[model samples]
Target: MAAAWHRLWPVLALGTALLLAGCDEIGLKSSLSPQPRPASLRVVPPTPVAPSAQSLDLARYYHKVQNDLLTRGLLRTDGGGPDTPYSADDLARNFEKIVFYNEYSSGDGLSPAQRLQSGQLSRWSGPVRIGTEFGASVPPDQRSRDQAQIDHYAGRLARITGHAIAPVRNGANFHVLVVGEDDRDFLRRRLQQVIPGIGPAELDLFSNLPRSYYCLVIAVSGAHNPNDYTRAVALIRTEHPDLVRLSCVHEELAQGLGLSNDSPYARPSIFNDDDEFALLTSHDELLLKMLYDPRLKQGMTADQARPLTTAIARELMGQQPQDPI
Candidate 1:
């Protein structure tokens, strides 16, 4: 009996040891055991890139322009400085009553009153025409393609802003010429002949006439015969003081016709928070930044952002009594 008991104890002890090993493998442990080391989690931060020098220059230019305008009383400030950021709602609200006209044909011709009021057209006259001079050195195909892009943007501007943009033809009401070349020196020399201070870096020229029509000329500083190519426009508004006061292409088109230049903000519904997001993110830079923001990941789509932004701009601008110039 003593020999049998001794043999049974060895077998029982072996079974207990096997069971304990199995429990450790399955992560089962008594409170008396030491805690296992936790798995380390790694998180990555976003990379930062500095803006280009040209972009910084542009920002400075915009700041200076705003300051100058404010000093001249051309822009109003409600306690905020001229550099105050504006929301899409502000723009929309300010210019809600403004009207926009597109050059679309209706079944009926102009009425008698409409015909008489033609001269009173304050903003735009007709379709916009853009002329390109390919210069002797440039390939005709490239020139044509560039002109096509300009035409496309013109049409887009008209359609989006509901403004009348004249087509490019010999008798077009307004003409904008874009000249391009690969050589900067040649382009500068050509533009300098027309406007003494013209430089290679400054390629865009704008002129607003008394008839409420604006003419834009863009010189491509990089092509062959850059001078002759750049001076495609024979009549330049060299002496107009207001030529320098025109806003950017988009802003000019909107303000020229007395409409709000707020971006198109579209959303399914206008909830208060959505409205706030739209207004705060109207600026192009801010909008671009918010595109990748994690907070907005579940908030809105890119398409939805524009409409919301526009509504906010309108709200911020609201209506103000304009003193006639």
Candidate 2:
């Protein structure tokens, strides 16, 4: 029995050594043993920046101006005033004429001479005129305000287009007064009235105004009738196709008169496509805002600024076709 035990002892010792080695490979001892902990990681959150007062003021100013301009006419409480309500038909007709020019010039980018006849050219270069017949009840203040807005937009237009736009005095130019429900309808009627003499050819409403000024009458009152506003813009484009490239009125005014449209802070590009709205990258918005700032207006021409503007515009637009007008 002692001889058998001695032989088995060697086997038992070897087996115990093998089990210990396997435990080391499998980390069983480490699993069972107490261990020291690693140091804690420190993480800090980013700080936020507040917007400046100047930025807030400019935003507020823009909002107030737009609201004032939009609500000018409708806010009047006096019952019997100049009614400028226009029918959809009037708008459609004016739209049709304006759209004709939009299509004509944009078709293959025709020259003004090729696109417009002598008659069309005559009307465009002649005067900035408005024809309106008010009901005896319309207030004088309302009339003045309506005219003022036109003159304001016209002056802005002139500054942008390098043309001198002045408002002709009452009864000095062709004033066609159509008795209508409101200014919108009156404008439509006036436009229709003018189309026969001016011919059906499209005029660049923006470009063709007399270097001086002209007025059109609206019997309906509200902020410049958007229908009239749009039609007038279309008419301006019809008469002067060159203005189409100068789309944004704010940018156009700033750039045309040698003002800076760029800013230091990040902002969305004015030339951005409607489709790209919220998808703009921060870098791209920063680039656009810089270009649109008024302070940067110095020593820049439209030609020089166009490439940078276009690049940022395209980036904002993403992988899409260029915007149509």
What's the C-alpha lDDT at position 79 in model 2? 17
Each model's number of backbone clashes?
A: 41, 51
| Candidate 1 lDDT, 1-325, residue by residue in tens | 1111010000000000011000000000111111222234111211223434543553355455445544555432132333545545543322221211111112211111131110001122223444323223233544455456446645755554343453453433222322222222333444444333432223331221121111222221112211111112222211112212222232222222222112223221111111112111133322222222223222232344445435434333463323211
Q: Which parts of model 1 are misplaced by more than 4 Å?
A: 1-88, 92-122, 125-134, 180-325
RMSD of 2: 37.0
lDDT of 2 by residue, 249-289 (tens): 22222221111112212222221211111122233323324
| Structural similarity to truth (TM-score) of each candidate | 0.27, 0.24
Error of 2 at 239 (Å): 28
Off by over 4 Å in 2: 1-138, 170-193, 197-325
